[model samples]
Target: MPLTADLTSADLNEIRQSALGAADPLGVAADLAHSAEAGRLADPQDAGLALSLAAEIAESRSKFDAAQRYADAAVTAYGDRDDSPAAAARALRARILYRSGRADEANALVEPLRPLLTRYPDAAAYVTAALAVGGRARDAERWLTEAVQAVVAERGVTEPADADDAGVLFFLLQQRHRLRHALGLQHDTHDNLAERLETRLANANSGAAAAPATDLVFWPRAEFDRLAERTDAYGATWDEHRASLEQELVRQTAAGRTGLALLPGSVDALTAQAGIGGDPVSPENRAGYARALATGTARIAWPPERNGACWCGSGLKYKKCCLPRSRG
Candidate 1:
């Protein structure tokens, strides 16, 4: 039976957390299993995830039969997709089998999925955990290495392109670091870099000044120049807006307010704002614009990689093309 007609993944997460917080393992397992049963009709993937969590809770409560049942259901719900979610369910099922004294069954289930780890780096941790649960540490290490190689091939640079890339890289590195430490192996460059990234990401998430971040909308020089030439107001607002925006941003940054929105206006609204005459945009509209930008607006990360392509859609590298005018 479905707990609710419409329960998003977020809702399921909250439910799980609430049960855990209350120290109710039995309740957590029951609720998650029921939710997964209902959730499978709406979102099979999420339902699979929920069932995996339910299996874990059941395992912790020493209900091996129930745990195996949940894991099997999770695997079925996930289907045969070649993605992280499907891999995760299979891994969980393998772990449950191993812990339930079905070692041969566990190995058989997980062996074919080794190739899946190489194809999807994000699935490595799940597979590694399952292997560890089965006391196959060396096998886990080998698969982990393959996943790291995949990450290297996909990323192709020391510096990640964005936060998501950094996150994945960090996690894989962290896992490898811990495993090597346990095996009494010497640290490598990747391990050292993982330590550095740990600090960097920690500071970034905690909003520390040590790791500065900002978001801004960019208008390519050629496009803005054309608009400026179309009207005196456009030209005037261009200069005034540029200088004032930089000043305001600098002031806000100094005040430790990193997240902000300088909502862009349309050509007519820009003209009206500059007093060159069209219907003026109201304060309420401006407030709504800011809210929209905060919630779902897409903006470029300021300061593109020095050797990377410029954010302005120019063919030249950032340093050679538009870095000089980036402040404006």
Candidate 2:
């Protein structure tokens, strides 16, 4: 009858990871439902974990209807007793509403939680969820930025020199990038931000830090090449350009360079110069020329003059990993 005996340590750990991975409520709900039905719900913590995961998974999967049920279950299992957990459940519900295009409803749901932000400033999940649904991009960006700063301060670390924490930092950096892009700020404005991240990576490498290979997730390199080709296609739409830039941003952020600047030009200009539509790469077309210049600029300006070394200790330029795949 001992709970510890009934569940292996590995099983517990796996469940814990799954719980943390729950970015959707429905996923968390389904997991907990299965566990409860199987008569395997052991501890409150485990149950809470199941709820969180289910909710997150459901949200990400765009199953808002299912997510609400799981969020409620999680709140109930957590006894709806603790303010933190309750707030989290509420946030999950809000996320579902937001994803379902009921933004107004979602905003109203989390409006009451505004006061909590000042108290639990470091609660990135709560803050992000609240801002996202609240229809306040500027506010959300500020909160997210502050939260990241507070985390860095609490750790007494100026830089995330550790590779194991790269994933988390990468997400933060991506958020920063998105915020800047959404604001329509000039690309040069992020130059300093890019430098700081590059320096952090270099510092980690200098310390001979070794990130667990197991923790690293490698995307297929071919995907990047394919994206490059697509972006190069003649008559590419704005959406296509945006998608390509977004993918490039994700890749670069993972590698520790957060700066992604889009050139100030119209999509038509880009397509015309690239000779994209069966048009040969020519001086008049200039598409190839522009692409080459952009790629070259990124590489040369990378490592931000502030970052002196590579985080992998390879003594290579940060752009080798952090820059977009070069066409030139």
Candidate 3:
């Protein structure tokens, strides 16, 4: 049966706050599931938060089947809201469907919602990713471009409440980043893969957006080297990792790992996942890394210079073409 009781605004708001603030979503899922059946957390909204959080964590951990179940539960939980949040759950499920090899079903499910894009940045991001997975990458970019423009156009006005999150602001720019790449447009910051991925992880956490880890600093290449070392994933085989690895060779390449791109956790997760445990950049490593990169021997070189020509060979300046799309 559908969850029937309406939650008090206080109850729902508190739930939303806690879900967004959660570091590890597993506990949130357990807690909500426990209370919800007893009518303590009765609203469909509670189910929305619980199932969506579980789905995101499942997707991040690469439990595709589990992710699909969580997403389906989320859509069912929303109980016919046909609004952006309901559509967001379906969009997320569409991604899992596509990845599970049901490309046509996924596309058919989410394509109509493309015209119903929400002002919520995360909703926009989800719909964009779903379209890209459905063999309509070009259409995804067009939808994202329009969705982003729509949000930016009302930045000071009708922006969603979550708009204040740095992650949300960052998401807007990051989607702008992917849209430019998908369309072969140029930009100044197209080459900074580390920042791109880090910002993405920050965005992926279920919240709109961080903590004291601003103290920990890292150079872009350090991030590349760190991620490179995680080749021995518990979940994926070497060949599988290698195939996705190819897309990482360039900053503009946007394939793979879309979940981490909009991570909702605070700077703490960002620090742990992307900042080398929040250790500051070192001069010795920086210089040595630079030399190795200059000689093309570094594990990962800094992206194309900001003032350099477009990576796409468009003869335009990087800043004009793609750099500006990044929040960095």
What is the C-alpha local distance difference test score of each model?
0.63, 0.49, 0.51
Best by TM-score: 1
Top model number, lDDT: 1
Q: List ranges where model 1 is wrong by over 4 Å.
A: 1-6, 38-45, 118-122, 157-167, 206-328
Q: Which stretches of candidate 3 lie over 4 Å from their true place?
A: 1-44, 132-136, 148-174, 178-184, 188-328
Clashing pairs in 1: none
Which candidate order results from sorting by TM-score in descending order? 1, 2, 3
**Weakest 10 consecutive residues of candidate 2 by summed lDDT:** 211-220
What are the TM-scores, per candidate, against the unseen true structure? 0.57, 0.44, 0.43
Ranked candidates, highest lDDT first: 1, 3, 2
Q: After superposition, how far is residue 313 of candidate 3 from its true place, in Å?
A: 30
Q: Which prediction has more favorable TM-score, 2 or 3?
A: 2
Q: Compared with the true structure, what per-residue lDDT tens digits does model 3 show for residues 1-328?
A: 1224444546645655665456855555545444443445545356665666667666766778877878887787888786667878888999889889988889788877876763566677788787777676777766766665555555653213222343444565667676655665533221132234444465556443321121112223233344334322211332222222222333223322221111111223333433454322222232233333333322322245779874433467766753443322
Q: By the TM-score metric, which is better: model 1 or model 3?
A: 1
True lDDT of residue 119, candidate 3? 51
lDDT for 281 (candidate 2): 25
